[model samples]
Every structure is written in structure tokens, then in C-alpha cells.
Target: MRRTLDEFNDRRWIDKDGYQYVATRLGEAIASGIEDLIERVETERKLRSVWQWLPDAISAFPFETWSDLTITVAEPDAPYRPVGRFESLLRETTTVRFLRPEVALMDLCFDLLYQLIAEGVEMRLIDRPECHRYFLSTYPNRSSEMIRQDHFTILEHDNLPSYGTGLLDDCVTISCYERDSGTVHALIDTDAPAVREWAESLYETHRADARRVELQKSAESVPHD
Candidate 1:
């Protein structure tokens, strides 16, 4: 059975021992995937392109819990387009390890990258009679006020979709952070063709942003001698 955030938190899911175990396993998986992508990029002599390395990086980690994983890269500063979708499968079962600084950093970077690419995605804590989990913003930011108004005015609501409903109605983004573990997974779902196209366009934008950052750094590094 799937565990809710409250149940997991009540059970001290983020305890040191549990956090360590999850982080270590997740880190190793991500590192391996990145390394493989790096090798392939080098062979193809496309080392300068981050997008070229993404596929291998994603393929490196097997997604066991998340049924769908989609990425969209947009223009620098623009919201991401839906790149593609993925289904995760776990290869093995193992015990937890301690969370090292490196592992934590890796997890943070992954989340940051996802947030940057997928702008306006909010994380909300949800509660149901049977389960609770952090639900990602499936709808655009504009709908937030309407949701808030509806929340206070209504006593009982039935139209809202549950987390991981696997429906294609609203574009959903699920950020998964293992309880009692350090692993973090972000899943995005959107059946909209326009959204997907936007995600792909974001890749070019990301490259541009990277170049701008480098330029700024170079400008700052110049000194009067």
C-alpha cells in the first residue's frame, strides 16, 4: 500500500538512518546515469550541449515508484515544454544507507533544475480520508485564486482529482522525495501538445542562460592589475 506523508512523517520517515539510506541509493543511481551520459557526449563530441546528455542521464536511474516521468525544456527563462514521458521500474531491493553531504547536494541540484525548467509549479500538501501526499501543480498558476476561493466556500468537494490519478486532464507535476530516505523524484505529466513543444524549446533557452551566466562570471573575474 502507498504511504501518506502524514503517516510517514508520524513514523519519523526523515530520521537520520532512513534519510541516509534513501539518499545514498538515489545518489549512486543519478551519478551512474550522469557518468554514462558524459561518456556518450564525449564520444559524439557534443560535450557543449547539455540537452544531448539529458537522455542518458535520465535513463541511468530506474524509476520504480513513479509511473510517469516527463521533461520539457523551454527557452531560457521560459516555462519548459513537455519533452517526453518515462515509466520507472526498480531493478533491485536493498537496505537504506546514511545521507552524505554529497548525496544531499545532488538531490538539491536535481530539484532546483526541475523547478527552474518547470516554472509556476507549486507544491501543496494534500489530505484525504485514506491517503495524503504532496501534490504538484497540475494546473497553471492562474487557477490558484479560484481554487483558494472554492476551498473556503465549499464544504464538500468532489471535482478535484487525487494525486497520481493517471488522468490526462490537468497537466500535473509530482515531486517525490522518499520518506526515511534521501531520494527525490519529480514527475511531470501533460497531454497538451503545446506544453510539450514549449518544454523542448526551453532547452535552447537553458543553453542561452548558461552562456549568459558564464559571461557575467568572466566580466566579474576581470581585475585591474
Candidate 2:
């Protein structure tokens, strides 16, 4: 389910704008599920989020339980660094692909990626050219080393949109995110096979079209000063 649907469906709760409405079982279940997930995903570091509005203590979710993970981060929510769940997902997934330009370059997230790469996880990162410039600059050496040992690929895009995602192993659990009140919203789903398929298929198209990122200084060799 995309955020658009939620925004539209949620409006049904209040026929009058901004008016509070009673919660139904389905609505409560959805809210409860979100809280439980945030608790698990944020297990520690205790990141306060809207998803954690419920009173119960959060539960810890193991990464191994998910066969796939797809993450989308709105630009507004790209800066804040999240702990726990991501670490687990990074460690568990044999293959991870990223589409968020800003988040992909953040140290909080990418710094932890080295360990996964060292452990033989394949990570394919895609982002806009400007955002990925720093990455491509220092990538040649590392790419040479890891490409042979593990799957390490970076692609350059010129005009990617605000919405972005990461498709993990097989297309099982896909995580969705947005922003409100300087906090990031989260959604992790395992039941949406159709969504998973669409995400993977979208990534495939990008993969087919994605070009290797590289830097070329000049066509002619620089003359001695």
C-alpha cells in the first residue's frame, strides 16, 4: 500500500476536515501493527517516532525472518540516522540494492555497509550523479577489490525522483518511509507480493538502464608545467 492510498483512505475517518473520529478494529490493528514494528525496528536507541505512539514496549524483530526488504525514504526524512533494524537487514541480506540518493551517501548508513561487504554481501547502490559523485570518486579502488570478491556496483542517474527504495534478497518484506514533524515514518511489509514484484521489476528496469559511475578528467594527457 502506498502512502497516497493511506492519505486518501484516512480521510474517510473524518468526513469533516481535522475532526477526530472513532477507531475501528481494522484501524486499531493497523495502528497496533505499526507500533509493534517500530518497536522492533527501533529496538534500541529508542528513536521516538509517530509510529511509536502506542504505549506498549517495542518488540525486537530478527532480520533473518525477512526474505526481502525494500526501503523508500522521502527527501525530508533522509537525514536522521536510524539504528537496529537497518543493521540487521544490512547484515542478513545476501544482496541489497539502494535507490535513495541522499540517504545512500550518509555516513551513519554507509559506514556500516563495509562490514557487510567484507562479509560477502552484495550491495548495488544507485543515485543521482551529483549525490553519488563523492562515492564514485573513491570507489575505483574498493570496487576493484570487492567486485571480484563480492557484488559491489554503483550506478549513476541524472534525474531520479524524491521517492526511493532498496530491494533486498527476494522481494519479501519491503520497508516504506515518509516524514512528519522532523521524524521519519516507517512501514515494513511481508504480505504484499504484488508490491514486492512491482518494486523488483522497477529495480530491474533501472538495472538494465543503469550505467556504471566513473570519472574522466580529460581526453588528452595533461602537459607538464
Candidate 3:
């Protein structure tokens, strides 16, 4: 400890104040820079696993909002943690708009979504063709029933991000998945205005390019068991 202080003192990073030592202005500035670097590193650490899956727009987000995000990472012991968090958010929202590459909705979420739809909660979904086919095949009856409702809407977009973006009520969430396994690895949620704005913009852009999924056509496109 004494040797470290001597080194710092030699560099004028610390100065003697009677019997006590105080940091110099240069030392304070260096400390602040170090603190900022640590914060950036920590933020990167938290986002690294899911970073590749995130949309390009997220890269431009303000650094301050990164800390405000609620990142729910799937654990080895409980691999469904991210999905559970999203389901909880789904239950509370009256409106949902999402760009989905895959069907991350579990059985319970489908039931809750059904109830929400019957209660007139609005939902607009943009999904890839294969994912839409999978959903239709997996939940034939429910998909048919829900697609017929006025509150539910679907669009098919061939070029969607590997990750999913969901705008549930006022909150925005980015669901990252493992590419090979197709499992939800993390769910990043936030109410930051910048993120919400970006999400809404992206949703609208994709919605414009996507083809609407007609109830009759979609049903015929997929074979049932």
C-alpha cells in the first residue's frame, strides 16, 4: 500500500496535505475516466451474448439508457426465465405490436393472449413465413379462431431480424434467441423514450413492406394434423 502511494505521489497523482494525502486534479480526472470505462465495460458485458442478435438501431441508443434496461437472461437451471418474463409483460399490456422471427409464445401465453383478444385487446404481429407456418401448424384451432377476430392482425415479412422486437403497451422489449437451438436467451425491456421511438419506427417500416396474412389463405398454406 505504501509503495503504491509512493508511486502515485511520484507521478503527482497524490499530494501531501499535512499528515493526510489528497488526490490532485489530474488524479480526479483520471479516476473519472476510469469510472466511465468500467461502466462501458460492464454494459458491454451484460449485452455481449445478445449483442449480435440486436437490431442495428439499438447500437445508436444513448449510453445512459443501457443501465435502465431490465435484462432477463435465461439461466442454466431455469432456461425459460426470459420467456416467463415476457409472458408476465404480455398479461399486463392492453396492446401489443411485435416483429417476430420465431414463435416464442408458450402454451400459457397463447391462453392468456386468447383471453386478452376476447376482451378486445389489440395486437398486431409481423412474422416470417416459416414462423407463421409453424404457429399455424402447432396451434391450428387457436390460430384460426384468433385470426378471425377484429382485434388480432398478422403480416408476413420475409426479412426479419433474428431477434424479436415487441412493443407491449408503453414498454419495449428485445428478445434475443440462440440461433442454432432457437431458444430465448435474453429479454431486454425498457420504457426509455428513445428505445420506444426506435421500436415504433422499425415496426412501422416493416409493417409497410409486409404482406397481410389473410385467414383463409394462411389456413390453406399449412397442413393440419
The candidate that achieves the highest TM-score relative to the unseen native structure: 3
Pairs clashing within candidate 2? none
**What lDDT score is found at residue 182 in candidate 1?**
29
Best by lDDT: 3
Ranking by lDDT: 3, 2, 1
Alpha-carbon RMSD, candidate 3 = 3.7
Question: Judged by lDDT against the true structure, how good is candidate 1?
Answer: 0.29
Off by over 4 Å in 3: 1-41, 106-108, 217-225
Q: In the order shown, what is each candidate's alpha-carbon RMSD?
A: 25.5, 14.5, 3.7
C-alpha lDDT score of every prediction, in listed order: 0.29, 0.50, 0.83
Identify the runs in model 1 with alpha carbons over 4 angstroms from their true place.
Answer: 1-69, 72-148, 151-170, 181-184, 192-225
Model 3, position 56, has a per-residue lDDT of: 79
How do all models score by TM-score? 0.18, 0.49, 0.78
